[model samples]
Target: MKGKKILFILSGSIACFKACEVVSALIKNGAEVQTCATKNALNFIGEATLEGLTHKKVYHEMFESGSYLKHIELNSWAELTLLCPATANIINKIAAGIADDFASTLLAANDYKKPFLIAPAMNVNLYLNPATAESIEKLKKRGVVFIGPETGLLACGVKAIGKMSEPAEILKAVKEVL
Candidate 1:
């Protein structure tokens, strides 16, 4: 994955902190990472932390002055797009073609021929919900790849699936892809 361009999307999930480790690993592997975050994501991991790591600004709005096309530009700029700590909300939005927010809109603009991946992180019940499950299936059918939401303890303190894959594993997956 040396010198690859990765557009990383962060959604609202406690796993955002863990996803930061993946971002760091991507940089160490010589990949240039640009982050796009959701408003709720910043509630868990600050924008400054993402900006500091990537050395690029964190885009969380669709209508930033002088960069109204930022979301489309980001999609075109990336060789691969990965959404880590993907919450059920974001997943469903992508599946349903909802792009009301910057993060979701950027995802909607993803180039289908390019590698697009999502690593889901949410409560087990939410993960297992019919709506979320259907959304995942829809995305998979549309050629979007999904990484692990491993079975383990969750932020809510219950042991089950819907845990985002660990940083090392996520990095390995990214390496294998590009």
Candidate 2:
């Protein structure tokens, strides 16, 4: 993975913390990683932590003046894009071509020629919602790869299939995609 440019996008989820491990693993394995997060995801994981791990600023806004064309530029620069811990909201937005937020905008503007992966995380009901399932199918048809919302104990105090896959699993998926 040396010299490969990876864009890691994180969405709102309690599982956002695991994205740090994904970033660290990517960097440790010699991939250049740039991270972007939804505003809500930042609540679960700090910008400093992401920056510290990635050696690059965590982009959390679509309107940053300094990064006027960041959504486009980052896609062009990355060899792979991973939406680790992808939320149902973000997934639906991307599936529907909504670009209201930084992450969604990035997805909407992406050329889709690169490897694009999404690892969903949510409560069991939400993950199993027909809308969410349909959205996932839409994204899959568009060539988006999904890692997991594995079946297990969730943050919501239930044992079900909504947990994000572990960092190692996500990293393995990233490697396979790359």
Candidate 2 lDDT over 53-171, as tens digits, reads 98799888988888779988898999999998888899889888889988888889888899999999999999999999999999899899999879999998999999999999999
- Per-candidate count of clashing residue pairs (backbone under 3 Å): 0, 0
Judging by lDDT against the true structure, name the best candidate: 1
Please give the lDDT score at residue 126 for candidate 1: 96
Q: Write down the TM-score of every candidate.
A: 0.98, 0.98
Q: What is the C-alpha RMSD of each candidate to the true structure, in Å?
A: 0.7, 0.8
Model 1 ranges off by over 4 Å = none
Q: What global local distance difference test value does model 1 have?
A: 0.93
For all candidates in order, the CA lDDT equals: 0.93, 0.90
What lDDT tens digits, residue by residue, belong to model 1 across residues 1-178? Answer: 7789999999999999999999999998899999999999999999999999999999997787866999889988999999998999999999999989999999988868999989999999999999999999999999988998999999898999999999988888888888
